[model samples]
Target: MGADELSATLWRGRRQLDFLLFLLETQLLHLRAGNWHRLNFTASELEKVLENLRFESLARGVEATALAKEWRAPDQFTLPALVEIAPPGVWAELLDEHRRALVSLVKDIDGAVAANISILEKGPDEARAGLDDIEILATQVNIERALAAVSEASLPFLRDFLGLS
Candidate 1:
């Protein structure tokens, strides 16, 4: 739970966020292209990443708490608080960088999700306009199942990130 360990966790979390953003972009492309199969796969991948992020978040909380206690900061200190109290050199700068990058990544993810939702709101007829009867049925089933699973698992994480709960 030292600064180095906390830094490593932050680094890993950033990479995970980057991968999540990539998946969101890919999911949006598949939605626009009407590639239901790939979209389903991406949805599953997103679930896995979200699960990993949940665990990573717990680990980060523990590490951050320990570091905060070591530094004599108040309870439930935020990354910004940590940055403010960090030794005035590489650690302070690095933590600030991580915080900024995470914020930007979260905003990008939010934008991508909004775009995907907009395309989805256009309805199945527009999305599946070119598909044959069988393809439409299969796509509908697969997309429904995949999106339901993702939405169920993703809502809490999104809510937490967006400070909704």
Candidate 2:
């Protein structure tokens, strides 16, 4: 695979990561509110996103491997390694940015997962107290903000896929 193909795959992966993070955050909110119904739906959606991410990851691996071979790098190259061996130009900088963003998203996902687990482990009264501490208005605002961010982030991918100028 060429650099352009690898770049496109990376973009798709990034979008998937963004969506995954949004869903996880939404799930956390639902968990905090003890809204099992909405949480179930969000969990289902999260699974779908995870599956898509898996495919994207495979494609990325293939493309990265090809690029590595083209650049005479080792077979088991990681993103950091790719960045190191990348030509001194835009591609290198772009790949490094992606690496950083992916790392941050993974960390955020971990935190959300841990928080959800902690809430689930709490006693009923404790959980209720936790929920009481959250402001309904603030949760609504956060949901709206996350939705807007996801939609805005998706526009460039939509335009590119549709061949829009």
Candidate 3:
């Protein structure tokens, strides 16, 4: 893929990550407030976001594969690999930094999501069985906040990559 194509692809992926972080934040609020009604709605929203993230990831994978092929790199090579292998350039370094931050946020979100799933798997019955939903909810909120902060930090790099004024 060409530079512009790569930029657009990364832009789309970054936006997907942003929206995913937003959905998770909203879900955290619902969990924290113990609003079962809102939680159900927000959970559905998260499901949709997760689906979108999946498709975006797939599209990015295709683009990255094309980029790797363009450079004659190994099939397993990815965008970050491209940056590391190629000579230092302004955009490449910026993209690599942003990607690393984005990846860290994803890991945080993933951990929070797994914890939320564990709480969910216990069910309402487990709440009666002495599971501290409030504590779990609080932990969930904190975890999500960390992810939101990371997403916020990534905004500048994303805008730069997209060539936004």
lDDT per residue (tens digit) for residues 1-165 in model 1: 778888898889889878888887888888788666675687788878887888888888888888888888888477888888997679889887888887778777778777766665554676667778898787777676556534543435433432434
Top candidate by lDDT:
1
Residue 25 error for model 3, in Å? 2.2
Ranking by lDDT: 1, 2, 3
**Which 10 consecutive positions of candidate 1 have the poorest summed lDDT?**
153-162
Model 1 TM-score relative to the real fold: 0.82
Question: Which residue pairs of candidate 1 clash?
Answer: none
* lDDT scores in order: 0.74, 0.63, 0.56
lDDT of 3: 0.56
The positional error of residue 113 in candidate 3, measured at the CA in angstroms, is 1.2
- Residue-wise C-alpha lDDT for candidate 3, range 27-94, written one tens digit per residue: 65665555533554565566566566667666666766676676676765655666765544665776
What's each prediction's TM-score? 0.82, 0.71, 0.65
Q: After superposition on all CA atoms, how large is the RMSD of candidate 2? A: 11.0
TM-score of 3: 0.65
Using TM-score as the measure, what is the rank order of every candidate, best first?
1, 2, 3
